[model samples]
Target: MTETSPRPLRVLAAMSGGVDSAVAAARAAEAGHDVTGVHLALSANPQSFRTGARGCCTVEDSRDARRAADVIGIPFYVWDLAERFREDVVEDFVAEYEAGRTPNPCLRCNEKIKFAALLDKALALGFDAVCTGHYAKVVTLPDGSRELHRASDTAKDQSYVLGVLDERQLAHAMFPLGDTLTTKDEIRAEAERRGLAVAKKPDSHDICFIADGDTQGFLAARLGRAEGDIVDEAGNRLGGHDGAYGFTIGQRKGLRIGHPAPDGKPRYVLDISPVDNTVTVGPAEALDVTALTAIRPRWCGRAPEGPGTYTAQLRAHGGETEVTAALEGDELRVAFTEPVRGVAPGQAIVLYDGTRVVGSATIATTTRRDRTTAPTA
Candidate 1:
């Protein structure tokens, strides 16, 4: 008696026109799966900016994806997801910033637009699973639960942005490049060997919506700039700013203030009060925080029922720190094992268990336990 071979799966590979995604499709085809390449048209303003090889959903990118699909000998199509992308991703990004919270657009895109909406569409069209080039992996456990894990390539690990996915989504997703590859360079080298057009393309950077790194200008254009006061910790006016939306926590440059600290020390923006139209500057130490609160949390799978210690990353590419987390109603309270500097209120706090992503939430506020005043009778 001989062991039976597994049947080939029907896979829909999302082609971003990057070397990684192109190679992902090629790998899927090589694995003997029925692969269909899809390029999602995510932007309505296709001509607003030059469609560089790095950016996604551009005209040139779509063409590159089609060429790759042709080379891989897979059925390819371009789906117009611009409306959904605007609603689920762009709107959420603007709303979060307007509410004085920093939001990760990529996380929102993965949660609301890509894995959920796009995956559903693929399944509806009779695909077994959707695949992408994300530097992460989906594992099936012995007990029949699906788990999300970091890719074999630690340097390109994208588990932070993908921490919001639920178990069902994880079960239906595929990362073809998860186990075999490590670096972008290696992936590109494979693509070149395969004669794929996107092999030499550069990776996209910054927010996809913003053509350049112009968050302040983008916000001002949308919300309208208003004159505001820049003050010190003691409420003494130092200078003026265009608006509170122009600043972010931990920023040092672009402050047009002329004031030097009385002690000849460097001053940092401590707080931004949108209500009072004020930006406060103080010593760098004022930025240290020990605890933070996050709202509207989404776990990679179901989160643990109670408080536990986990590693949390504050920014996209930042270092992870140990923290104790607890759920309070819909909010999460994260007490860091050590003090973290510049824990901005509007950023993301992604939780991880070893190499596996646990969940993520937007920071609502941060408090320094060492600096808090004691309660009095």
Candidate 2:
């Protein structure tokens, strides 16, 4: 083998039945790995999942994955993780929202299902690594320590969502598409050249379980509607709401207040109190958060020694902001260099050191620029 040749090993490629995963599996097989394909059945009733390009893990996706595996000359199987998905991702999403905090189901799915459960099964079955189409790179140092980094294609980089992966998961992960600097169009062309049927399949979006993409409706259906008060920061009742879980911090629209603020400025959701079932709306300036306290930090390699400056990404698709962070026992306290608007609890805060992912933690509390802290619940 050449110096650049990958060592032959047992590789489990998770085929999501899309252009990216299909191409990734093919590339892994082409690189001299002994590959097998597997598609995760996340929903018990596959028909209830999203169709076309709006979602994944549906019956349609399973069939597409099987075909791609056949084309790649690898064995394929579908693993039923429906119950696990419900308990971990779906239930956790509802629980977080019910507690007046916004949760990212995609991040939870990546952390719980793809990395934890699926990777654990693969490792137990004697697989050397779990391969995926995620647009992020895993670099191994000379000492064999692995580091997660952003993909070459910054536009399609997925390092933020994958930040929840710790050192153990990183060691047995393979991302075949991370080194490609070409555009998605080029990837489609490659798929076409390779005779893959999903060459033009559109990418999945939104939460996969919620087929209709109506998150508020989904939550309402599960948690039932409870009338609540929408109040201003001063405790003035501005309006009524069906449920406090329907609103998130920094939300300015769908408030249905009937009347504008006293200064004619738009009001944004600043706080959500599950205890009192109140959604606090205030001026946009009141939403600026200067510091936050996060819990359950997961590092890609070793934990940071003490207080250090790093760029923190509040959301999966959002940009990074400079922050000074320190670990105090079980919590991670981060002080942002500049105030950021719209941060909510239950969301994951991914820390990055330049292009490398450092770690991630769930936002438990946020301190506003005025030195007032929101309730941890």
Best by TM-score: 2
lDDT of 1 by residue, 1-377 (tens): 00011567788899988888888789878888899999998888865534567648778888999999999999999998999999998888776666656678888888888898889998899987788888788877767677888788878888888888888888778887778655677788899899997888989878777776688887888888879898887899899988787877767788788967888877787887778878888777778787999987987777779999999998878888999999989999999887778777768898889988888888988986445462211
Q: Tens-digit lDDT track for model 2 on 278-332?
A: 9999888888888999999999999999899999999878998999999999999
What TM-score would every model get versus the actual structure? Answer: 0.94, 0.96
> Would you give me the overall lDDT of model 2?
0.90
- Error (Å) of candidate 2 at residue 67 is 1.2
Error of 1 at 225 (Å): 1.6
- What C-alpha lDDT do the candidate models reach, one value each? 0.81, 0.90
Candidate 1: segments with Cα more than 4 A from true spot: 1-6, 369-377
Give candidates' CA RMSD values in order: 3.7, 3.1
Candidate 1, residue 318: the lDDT equals 88
Candidate 2 stretches greater than 4 Å from native:
1-5, 371-377
